[model samples]
Target: MEALEKSREHVIGLFRVVVGLLFACHGAATLFGVLGGPQGAKPDVAAWPGWWAAVVQLLGGALVLCGLATRAAALLCSGSMAYAYFVEHQPEALFPLQNGGEAAAMFCWSFLLIAALGPGRWTLPSLARLRRRPGTRPITRTSSTSSL
Candidate 1:
């Protein structure tokens, strides 16, 4: 239990990285027609909802992955997914299983969790701060005369 508690931050960091990567990949597929391409026809440039959603996914995921403005990015991502689920999926069916909205629902909840929990230990800004900390100086040697 203690070990699990100690590793919680690392686990959260890993979770954030994975979720961000997956979301980014989804956006890349939709926008650039890569990674197996979009599930359907690619949206026209500056198209409604679809194009804008893709943009948010790409930018927000990148920010969350880097742990820069993670909470805000995650919140945006969550909202987007929630919109996707409700607007695109729920009309077809009341439940995710029936409507094929599992991915959207999952992403929405995952991002919400990330927003609440934070970016954990592996944030880029935190690493930069660590590097710039005042006390972590390099060792130095001084010459001294010795008498026996």
Candidate 2:
């Protein structure tokens, strides 16, 4: 059981890393026009939403990828993707298939899950710092506390 739990944690960590890297890749593609991106269409960087979303993608993706403030970064990324899907893609068609918003929807949900699950044990600068410190001995429940 312990080994299985450990394996699960490791897999979650791998998932986090993979997802973070891929999200960051999207940011890189859009921001720098690299990785076969920009698709011959360049969004106006000085504009309002376009540049703002790109900045969030790049910065948030990087932060999530590095496991720093993973939950917050993932949440922000998720919101950005949600906005992209609704504002840019959803109006084009009713369904994702016709609207071309599959990626956006997927990214939004993925980042939401990441935010919910947190950094999953392998993250650097773990959020554990915000929690109570570990005690030298394992905590055990006592009968006296049962009344509470």
Candidate 3:
């Protein structure tokens, strides 16, 4: 049962990391125009909403990825996606299919889930262990020299 619980936590953590990575990629594409954007031309840093959203995505995604302030970062990311869906896509049509807002909707929900559930037990191993008693040593197996 404990193993199963740990497995579930690891899976959730992996999901969070992957989502953060994808979100960060979107920011990189828009901010740096590296992955694919406007033929390699970066978005204007002074732009109103687009630039601001990208900055949030980049920074928030990183925090989520590292499991640091995961809840707050996920909340911000979720809000940004919600804003994108409503402001940029909702006016086009009633459904996401017609509005071309599938990604936004998905990201919004994903980040919301992360915010609610948290980083889980699989948060970066070293950092997680740092919370343990200062003088405590991690347990490890050792080979027996004498016959059992």
Distance (Å) between predicted and true CA of 123, model 1? 0.9
Query: Candidate 1, 92: how far from true, in Å?
Result: 0.6
Assess the local accuracy of residue 81 in candidate 3 as a C-alpha lDDT between 0 and 100. 98
Off by over 4 Å in 3: 1-6, 38-42, 125-148
Give lDDT tens digits, candidate 2, residues 78-97. Answer: 99999999999999998999
Q: In model 1, which range of ten residues has the least summed lDDT?
A: 130-139
Against the reference, the lDDT scores of all candidates come to: 0.95, 0.81, 0.86
Model 2: lowest-lDDT 10 consecutive positions:
127-136
Candidate 3 local lDDT, 1-148, one digit each (tens):
8887769877888989999988888887788776766323465886878888888888888888888889999999999999999999999998999999999999999999999998975566546787778889867899979976
Candidate with top TM-score is: 1
TM-score of 2: 0.76
- Model 1: CA > 4 A from native: 133-148
- By TM-score, how accurate is candidate 3? 0.79
Candidate order by TM-score, decreasing, is: 1, 3, 2
